[model samples]
Target chain A: DAGITQSPRHKVTETGTPVTLRCHQTENHRYMYWYRQDPGHGLRLIHYSYGVKDTDKGEVSDGYSVSRSKTEDFLLTLESATSSQTSVYFCAVSAGVSTDTQYFGPGTRLTVL
Target chain B: AQSVAQPEDQVNVAEGNPLTVKCTYSVSGNPYLFWYVQYPNRGLQFLLKYITGDNLVKGSYGFEAEFNKSQTSFHLKKPSALVSDSALYFCAVRVLGGNKLTFGTGTQLKVEL
Candidate 1:
């Protein structure tokens, strides 16, 4: 509903392989975030970007990386996928403030065997 | 650091019955609280947020949340339950100046007819 869309809604890949998910927003929000949702962990922040070429690591950024080359697009890449990295990845965008509400994309379910 | 806790793993309510999902948080400064709902395979949808001012915050889909600073809680409530309301609910918190949000493990709501 926030003009956000995630590509490759579902994906499956073998362990030790590389994977990437894309998030696109038409809202032109300045803050973009990537989160992984697991059963016991509601949603853990993986990485976020506040502006073009400006990014920061989140609580669980161990095996993942992110890049925001433009205001409308953010990319999350798994250097080498692992079984433990299998989870639903969600992308969120906000209007550049902590108090502003963040809207989420449809999410991508990734499985690593 | 800011963190949120969803005490119940699941909640059940009959149609037309009042429903509540509990949430508690800990933060170093004034908190920005939020509630999100995820319907299976979909992304998280913003339900409501509490930044300041009124303690009772109303949101989408007939949902409301009360921010109790004394209790450090922001619980999601609905006057009457609907079977379609069954889904996963998540609580999140952000400190006054923090740029990121910390989320709880989530609670599953089961509204039956």
Candidate 2:
């Protein structure tokens, strides 16, 4: 376990509501990533942060946003939840090296109706 | 763009039988391959990775993967399967200097008694 924890392990909300999931790591890793897992789609990266205040979009960045103000915390927000955004969201962290393997959090299951 | 493919939607194997999960990737430069496993309701756990080294790499939980550049494949294999090995397996690829990983759709492994 990479000392990663995700808040709100499960959530259910109506469509068009705002949702924010938090990922906290005690490892102080330099790279943090957010991914959503859905049936038949595996895990798709939502967003990632290389360092404090530096972020980049991933393959499935739409409808989601991320911010990392500190090394140990990364946040993923759904500005307006949609039914299509219902999925298991996982947070991961790495040492930011090419050979390093990323460790994951326990994951949060969000459902939008 | 880097990409990964897992041809099988699911794989079934009996306990004590040899098992393999297929994975293939396409990348521009040298690729960094990875395998992850996710139990029901849990986040993905790192199994092993191939950065640069021998063709075979051992990982957690008595798992190992063979990297074949000729086939552009990094297949996950175990000599004998266990019931606890039943889970969703994912393959991912990242090219040199690329910060994000592209993942496959995932393969569900079912180990039966």
Candidate 3:
């Protein structure tokens, strides 16, 4: 309910294909984060951007990439999808770092076959 | 590096019964702890956070958490349980000057009537 939306709420694509999930926010927050939620793994950070064009890798950013060309949009792209990459992806925005409250979008459930 | 642990994979409680979810954290600096709740098919929602204040932190939806620096734990508790409270709970941690967060594996709360 934080004016955050994720495109393609559900997606199913074959392995080795390219896939992108978009997170758009209207909150004007400075920090945007991408996280993946898997069973038994809770939620792990995939990538995050502090500002436009300033992104950094997270704990689980091995096969994922992110970009923030503008303040409102944060995109998570899978260069070449793999079966292991299938998971529920969530995007969150925070006013600032250091324990600022984070607001999350609904989610994107991705399946790789 | 900062990390949090949720010992229970699942917790069961009867309606009107007191409920508690355990969380312990490890951080290099003063820890900033947070609790989030996730319903099925939805995104994570912030419940409460402990920054630099009283050890007892109260949050939304009749939830409260106690921060114990000696034990490095921040446990979530509610005086009474509700069937609607059934969801997955996550505990996350961040250092004083860190922008990234580390989350626990999540505990599933089943508040049964």
Candidate 4:
């Protein structure tokens, strides 16, 4: 367990409502990532941050947004929740070295109805 | 693009029996492979990774994965299965010069008592 924590371990929200998930890390890693896990999809990268404010979009960044204003926190926000966005969200941190391993947070289970 | 594939959806083994979960990968340059496990309602936990070095990589909880460049495979193996080992396993590969990882659909392992 790398010192990582995700807020709101479980959440249930209505469709079209805004939702936000938080990931906090104790280790000041240079890279942070947000991923969503589904039954058959394993996990899909939603967004990533290289520095405090430098972020990039991932393959599945479409209905999601991320912000990293500080080294310890990375936030993922869903502008308007949809049923398809219902999944387990995980936050991971890496040292930014090539071939480095990532440490994951506990995860947040979100369901949109 | 780097990608991983877990051919089996589920694997069943009795306690004390040897178990294996297959994983294949495709990448342009040398592949950085990883194995992770997820318990029900929990986040993904890092098991092992093959950055560079020996092909036989040992991981946590009596698990090991062999990297075969010729076959583009990194199959996870265990000498003996335990009921506590039952969980979902995922295979992942990171693209060259990129920090993002692509994961497979995942394989569920059931070790019966």
Q: Would you estimate the TM-scores of all the predictions?
A: 0.98, 0.97, 0.98, 0.98
- Per-model B-chain TM-score: 0.98, 0.99, 0.98, 0.97
Q: After superposition, how far is residue A93 of candidate 1 from its true place, in Å?
A: 0.5
- Which 10 successive residues of model 4 chain B have the least lDDT summed? B93-102
lDDT tens digits, residue span A39-60, model 3: 9988899999999999999989
Q: In model 2 chain B, where is the ten-residue run with the lowest total lDDT?
A: B93-102
lDDT of 4 by residue, A70-89 (tens): 99999999999999999999
Taking the tens digit of each residue's C-alpha lDDT, what string does model 2 give over A59-113? 8999999999899999999999999999999999999756678899999999999
Q: Which runs of model 1 end up more than 4 angstroms from their true locations?
A: none
Candidate 1 lDDT tens digits, B1-113: 67889999999999999999999999998999999999999999999999999999999999999999999999999999999999999999987668888899999999998
Residue pairs with backbone overlap in model 1:
none
For residues A3-41, could you state the per-residue lDDT of candidate 1 as single tens digits?
999999999999999999999999889999999999988
lDDT of 1: 0.94
For each candidate, report its DockQ versus the true two-chain complex: 0.85, 0.75, 0.85, 0.75
> Mind giving the per-residue lDDT tens digits that candidate 3 earns over B20-88?
999999888799999999998899999999999799999999999999999999999999999999999
The sequence of per-residue lDDT tens digits that candidate 4 reaches over residues B1-113 is 77889999999999999999999999898888999999987788999999989999999999999999999999999999999999999999986688789999999999998
Q: Which stretches of candidate 4 lie over 4 Å from their true place?
A: none
Clashing pairs in 3: none
Candidate 3 accuracy as lDDT: 0.94
Tens digit of per-residue lDDT, candidate 2, span B1-113: 78899999999999999999999999998999999998987888899999998999999999999999999999999999999999999999887777888899999999999
